[model samples]
Target: MSVQHPKESWLIGDQGYPLESWLLTPVGAPNTSKEQKYNRLHGSARNCIERAFGVLKSRFRCLLKHRVLHYSHETSALVVSTCVILHNIMTKAGIMLNEVEDEVAEDFDSPNNAVDSSQYIREGERTRSRYISTL
Candidate 1:
């Protein structure tokens, strides 16, 4: 459920984060039904993001919490961005990273390959419904 923008990706955040064009956040106290649904979808998306962080840390040791990045703030951010980009490329190609030497496996699929439209819709609806019930 990544938001596609002209220059960058859509980033979903919680209430504490500042609102920006690229940043989709939930309303603290949703009044309208539409706002409530938006909150549910935003919450569901954030759940996916949190799970992605877990997977990212597991796949890349540099992102592990125990390892402190001694780089400057901007440099550290760049390092993280680089790692995430690599992770996305590897995942798209179905490349499993077991060890340093294992990363050179044959690529399976292209990142731009088409996938089932319904599968994505069903998954999104399921995620949203699951989030709705928990509220």
Candidate 2:
């Protein structure tokens, strides 16, 4: 079940994801001043996803403790989905996350994974260029 978005709306993705009409990605090698500015804004906006994952892991200690989910792929997906639903429900009920006095430093570095963009290369480039022009 995919969430419906308006035609003008877009989902922000990092460099690892392919760009589409509904998805926006930053320019790899921005040349112009406007392009550079657009990339900065895009990156800032995309950081929300990272922060969200960090919060999720911090809240659900089991996910952080188990580097690799022992369960099958389908089971792991369901577990994650249930965790997300519980998190939302807890948040809505005004339950605060437990605070850790001794905060452990977390490495939130993004992996440099090469994603296949051959199919959407042209379309992605066009979309990026059009958005950059508006900036």
Candidate 3:
């Protein structure tokens, strides 16, 4: 779902439900149209973020451990924050030690099931248009 904020569209999360099950357009016209569009797009986009976070947490063991910093709450907060920043930087730079992407499942859907064809044609045309436009 997408949240309407002042400056940005925020993707809340995705349910395990398939996109083919979703109605492409909103039930009500004009009034809820933007909302339905937002939900579908946001739901799709958030899946990427969910996968990225899962990768980060699973690969970075340090994120799971707590550290004492100067025996103070404020200092500990600072330390943890610093560590997280450093971790992100290292990961981005391809320096952090972690499991390879090849071993991880990047797709947000179930592995065994084949791609559902109900929405494939429309989705493909949208994708193709986007792809061609980028050329």
List TM-scores for all candidates, in order.
Answer: 0.52, 0.64, 0.34
lDDT of 3 by residue, 1-135 (tens): 553444322214233333222212111111344444544454455656555645555555444435223447667567656666877888799885654332322233332233455664355335433332343
Which ranges in model 1 have alpha carbons more than 4 Å from their true place?
1-10, 88-135
Go through the candidates in order and give each one's C-alpha lDDT: 0.60, 0.70, 0.43
Q: What's the candidate order when arranged by decreasing TM-score?
A: 2, 1, 3
Model 2, position 65: C-alpha lDDT score? 61
TM-score for model 3? 0.34
Which candidate should be chosen as best, given TM-score against the real structure?
Answer: 2
Residue-by-residue lDDT tens digits, candidate 1, 1-135 = 564666434566555444445554455455667657776666666666677777677788888878989999889999999989999899899987543221221111221222335554344334434444556
Best by lDDT: 2
Candidate 2 lDDT over residue span 1-135, tens digit each: 566779667887776666666787777666789987887787666665666666778788667866767998789899888889999999999987864433222211332324456766666677778888888
Deviating ranges (above 4 Å) for candidate 3: 1-11, 14-36, 62-84, 96-135
Residue 12 of model 3 has an lDDT of: 40
